[model samples]
Target chain A: MNVLVQGVLLGGFYALLACGLSLMFGVMRIINLAHGDIAVIGAYLVWVLVNQTSMPPWLAALLVLPIMWVAGYVMYVLLLERSRRAGQLVPLLTTFGLAIVIENVLLQIFSPDDHSLLSSTGTLATSSISFGGLTISIFGMLTLATAVVVLIGLQFFLSRTTSGRQMRATAEDPDVAELVGINARAVYAKATAIAVAIAGLGGIFLAIRQTFNPSTGPTQLIFAFEAVVIGGFGSPWGTLLGGIVLGVAQVIGAQVNPQYFVLFGHLVFLAVLASPRGGLLSRRGRTV
Target chain B: MIRARGGQLSGGFRVQRWTRLSVVSAAVTVAVIVVLAVVPFLFGADVTEQLTSLLIFVILAVMWNALAGYGGLISVGQQAFIGLGAYGTIFLTQHGIAPYEAMILAGLGAGAVAVPTSLIMLRLRGGQFAIGMWVVAEVFGILVTLDAGLGGGTGISLNGLDVFAPGYRQAYTFWVTLACTTVLLGLVFFLLRRRIGTSLQAVLDDEEAAASLGVNVVRSKRVLFVVAAVGCGIAGALYLANTLFIQTTSVFGVQWTAYMLFMVLVGGLGTFEGPIIGAIIFYLIQAQFGDSGAWYFVGLGATAIAFALFLPHGIWGAVDRRLQLRLLPVGYTLRKLDTPASAGADPAATDT
Candidate 1:
C-alpha cells in the first residue's frame, strides 16, 4: 500500500513532464525531441535565478515560466516553422539538432556538475507527513496535488476557453481551421507556448526530486515518452494514467531489486507498446 | 532496335544501366580499395588506425543511409546494437574465442537481436519510431549495467588478443575492418542492383502507395533494419578491438547516431555515393576540430540542422544535379537514341 502511494506520487511527476509533450504532438503533429532539453534549460534558468539573485525557487520558477512561454512561441515561428516545410524527416532532425545543441550548451555553461534544486529549499526538501502506517514526502504530495490541479485547469481551458477552442480546431484540421479564420499559425504558436510553459514547470519539479546534469535530458525524455506512450499518445488524461502505471511498475521493480528500477519501467513500456491496443487506456488502438 | 550513343534500345530510347563515367568510377573505387588494403605495409600503426576509424565511419554512414534514405526507417537507437556487439565481443572473448573471430560473431549476434526488435519497432512511424528506438537503446544500456559480468556500467575489455604482437594485431585489425567494410558496402550495392531496390525506393517515396502496389514494405524495412544493426555492431566490435576497451557509456552514446545523421544528411540521402563523400568530410572535420569539446558537438548539431533545412539534398545532390554523375548508379536511366543526324545537335538533346 505504501509502495502504491509512492508510485502514484511519482506518476504525478511523470504526468507533469509528459502533458506538454502530448499537447505539442496534439497540436503541431511534431514530437519535440528536444522537449527534455528545453525542460532542463528551464531548470537551469530557475537554478541561476535562485543562486545568483538569492530569490526563492518558487518565485524564480514563476519568472522563468513566462520566459519559456515566450521562447517557445518565438522558437516555433523561427526554427520549427521553416524546418517543417522541408519534410517530415527534416523537422525531426531539426529537433534532434536542437536537443544536441541545448545539451552541449548546458554542458558548456554548467561544466557537467550535478545540481539539485532541493538543496536550496531548507527542510522542505526532507519534510514528510505520516498517516495510517504510511509516510509521504511533503514535496511528493504537493507535486501530486499540483499535477491534478494543472490537469484540471488544462481540461477546463481546452473545453471552455476561446484560445483553447482555436488550438483544438487547428489540431483537428489546420486547413479547415485556417478556412474558418482561426489563424492556425497563431493557434500553433499559442499551443507551443502553453506546452513549453508546462515543460518548465515539470523541470522545476524534476530538479526538486533529484540531482540533474546536462546529459540528464535524454533520460527524462525517455521517461516522458514512456508516460505518453503508456497513457496513449494524443490524449491528455491518458498521460496521467500512463505516468502512474509507469511509476508503479518502477516502484514494484525496485522492490525486487534496486538495479531493476529503470529496467522494469522500460520493460513495461515495451510491453505496452507491443500490446494490441497500444496502451491500457487507449480505445483508439495503435496510434503510433 | 535503335542504337543510342551508348547502348541498344528497344524503342526510341535506351534504358542504360551503366554510363562511361560509372565504369571509370568503378575502376577508381577498385584502385582506391587496393591502396587502402596495402596501407598497413606502407605506414605505421597510427595511420592504419586512423584509416580504420575512417572505414568504420563510412560503414556507419552507409548503413544509416541504407535504412533512412532508401527504406525511410529513421532509427536513433542503432547504438543499442553497437553496445551489444561491444559487450558480445567481450563475452565471446571470455568464452575462449579469438578476438578477431569474436568481433564477427558479435555482429551476427546483434543482427539476431534486431529481428525481434524490428517487429516492435516497425510498428511506429516518423518521430515515434525515432524516439522509440532511443528508448530501446536506453533499456539495453540499463540491462547491461545490471549484469556484473559485463562490468556493470563501467564495461569490460577484450582480453584474447595478447598472443599476437602489437604490429601484427594492428595489421590484422586493419585487414578485418577493410574486409568488413568492403563486404557491407558490396552487399548494399548488390541489393540496390536487384529488384528489391526498386521496391525499397517505392516504399521510401510512399509506404501506402507501395503497399497497394504489392511491395513488401515490412520485409524490406526489416531487412534494412537488421542489416544496419549488423553493420553498427561490427563497427562497435572493431572499436573495442582498436581501443581494447569497451564501456557502456562510450559504446551506447547517442553521439554515434549524431555522427551517422551528420554523415548521411550532409552527404545526400538516397544516394549510394553520398555517405562516402559525407564520411570523408566528417573525418576531415573531426581531424581538425575534434578537441574543441562541447563546442565541437554544438557545431556538428548546428551544421546538421543547417543541412537538414536549407540543403536537404546535401553537397552530393548539388554536384549530381550539375554534373549528372552517378559514381555508383543503381537506378536505370533512359536516353534518347543519338543517331549521326542528332550528334551535331545540343549535347542536352542526347538525354531524353
Candidate 2:
C-alpha cells in the first residue's frame, strides 16, 4: 500500500514533466528533445534568484515562470520556427543541439555541483502528511497537486478559452487555421510559451524533492518521454495515468531489486510500445 | 534516374560514372590508406592512438550517415550497440578467450542483437524514434550493470591481451581497425551502388509513395539500422582494444551520438564524402580543444545548431555546389551531349 502511494506520488512528478512534451507534440508535431534541459534551466534560474537575491524560493519560482514563458516564445520564433521551415527532422536535430548546448553551458556555470531547492524551503521539503494509513511527503503531494491542477487548467484552457481554441484549430490544420484569420505562428508561439512555462514548474518541483545537476536533464527527459509514450501520444489526461503507471512500475521494480528500478521502467515502456494497443505511433512503418 | 556506367560516351556525350576525377580521388584514397597502414612503423603510441580515434570517428560518421542520411532513421541509441560491443569484448576476455578475437565476435554479436531491437525501435518515427533509441541505450546500460561479471557499473577492462607486447598490440589493434574500416566503407559503398539505394532514396522522399512503387521501406531501414549497429558495435570493441577499459558511462555516452551527428551534419548529410571529411575535421578539432572540457562541448553544440539551421547542406555541400565533383559517384549527374546533332535536337538549347 505504501509502495502504491509512493508510486502515485512519483507519477505526479512524471506527469508534470511530461505535460509540456505532450503539449508541444500535440500543437506543433515537434518533439523538443531539449524539453528536460529547458526545465533544468528554469530550476537554475530560480536557484540563482534564491541564492543571489536571498529571495524566497516560491517567489523566485514565480519570477522564473514568466521568464521561461518569454524564453520559450522567443526560442520558438528564432530557432524552432526556422528549423521547422528547413525540414521535418530539422527541428528535432536543432532541439538536440539546443539540449547539448544548455547542458554544457549549465555545467560550465554551475561546475557540476549538486543543488537542491530544499535548502531554501526550510523543513517543508521533508514534512509529510498522514492519510488513509499512509504517510506521504508534502513536497511530493504538492507536486502531484500541481500536476493535477495544471492538467485540469490546461484542459479547461484548451476546451473553453478563445486563444486555446485557436491554438487547437492551428494544430488541427495550420493552413485552414491561417485561412480563418488565425495567425498560426503566433498561436504556436503561445503554445510553446505555455509548454515551456509548465516545464519550468516541473523543474522547480523536481529541485525541491531531489538533488539535480546539469546532466540531470537527459534522465528527466527519458522519464517524461516514457510517460508521454505510455499514456499514448497527444493526450493530456492519459499522460497523467501513464505517469502513474510508470511511477508505480518503477517503485515496484525498486522493491524487487533496487538496481532494476530504471531498467524495469524502460522495460514497461518497451512493452507498451510493443503492445498492439500502442495505436498511431506503434502502427508506423506501414511501408515496411 | 539515368545512372552513368562510366567507360563510354552516350548520345555523343561523356555522361559516365567513373571520370578522371574519380580515378584521381581513388588514388588519393589508396595513398591515404597505405599511409595509415604503416603508421605504427613510423610513429609512436600516441600517433597510432590518435589515428585509431580518427578511424573510430570515421566508422561512426559513416554508419550514422547510412542510418539517418540514407535510411531516414535518426537514432540516438546506437550507443547501445557500442556499449554492448565494448562490454561483450570484456565478457569474452573474462571467459578465457583472446581479446582480439573477442572484439570481432562482440561486434558480430551486437549486429545479431540489432535484428530483434529494430522490430521494437523502428516502430517510432521522427523524434520519438530518436529519443526512443536513447531509452534503449539506457536500458542496455542498466542491464550491463546488473550482472556482477560485467563489473556492475564499475566496468572491467580487456583481459587476456597481456600476452601481446605493447608495440605489437598497438600495431595489431590499428591493423584490425583499419581492415574493419575498409570493409565497412566498402559495404556502405556497395549497398549504395545497388538498386536498394534507389529504393532507399524513394523511401526517404515519401514512404507511402515508395511503398506504392514496390520499395520495401521497412527492409531498407532495417538493413541500414542493423548495419549501423554493427559498425558502432565494432567501433566500440575497437575502442575497448585501444583504451583497455569498458565502463558503461563512457561506452554508452550520448557524446558518441553527438560526435556522429557533428560529423554527418558538418561534413554533409546524405553524402558519402561528407562524413569522411566531417570526421577528419572533427578529429582535428578534438585534438586541438578536447581538453578544454565544457567550453569545448558548448562550442560544438553551438556550431552544430548553426550548421543545422543556416547551412543544412554543410561544408561539403557548399563546396560540391561550386566544384560539381563526385569522387565516389554514388549519385547520378546529368550533362548535355557534346555532339552537334544532340545540340540541334533541342530547339531551346543555348549556344556556347
Q: How do the predictions measure up, each by TM-score?
A: 0.95, 0.95
State residue B193's C-alpha deviation in candidate 2, in Å: 1.4
lDDT of 2 by residue, B226-336 (tens): 888889999999999999977888898898888888888899888889999999999999989999999899888888899989988788877776777778867665555
Q: TM-score of model 1 relative to the true fold? A: 0.95
For model 2, the local distance difference test gives: 0.87
Runs off by more than 4 Å, candidate 2: A279-288, B1-16, B341-352
- The CA lDDT at B81 in model 1 is 93
lDDT per residue for candidate 1 within B1-352, as digits (tens), equals: 2232357555455667678888899999989999999999989999998888899899999999998888887788899999888899998988889889999999999999999999999999888899899989988888888889989887687798888988889899999999999999998898877777888988877889999999998998898899989999998999888889878987888989899999988998878899999999999999999999999999999998888888877899778777878788777656666677556544341212
DockQ of 1: 0.78
What CA RMSD would you report for each candidate?
2.7, 3.3
Model 2 chain B: weakest 10-residue lDDT segment is B343-352
Candidate 2: tens digits of C-alpha lDDT, residues A202-250: 9998888888999999998999999989988877777898899899999
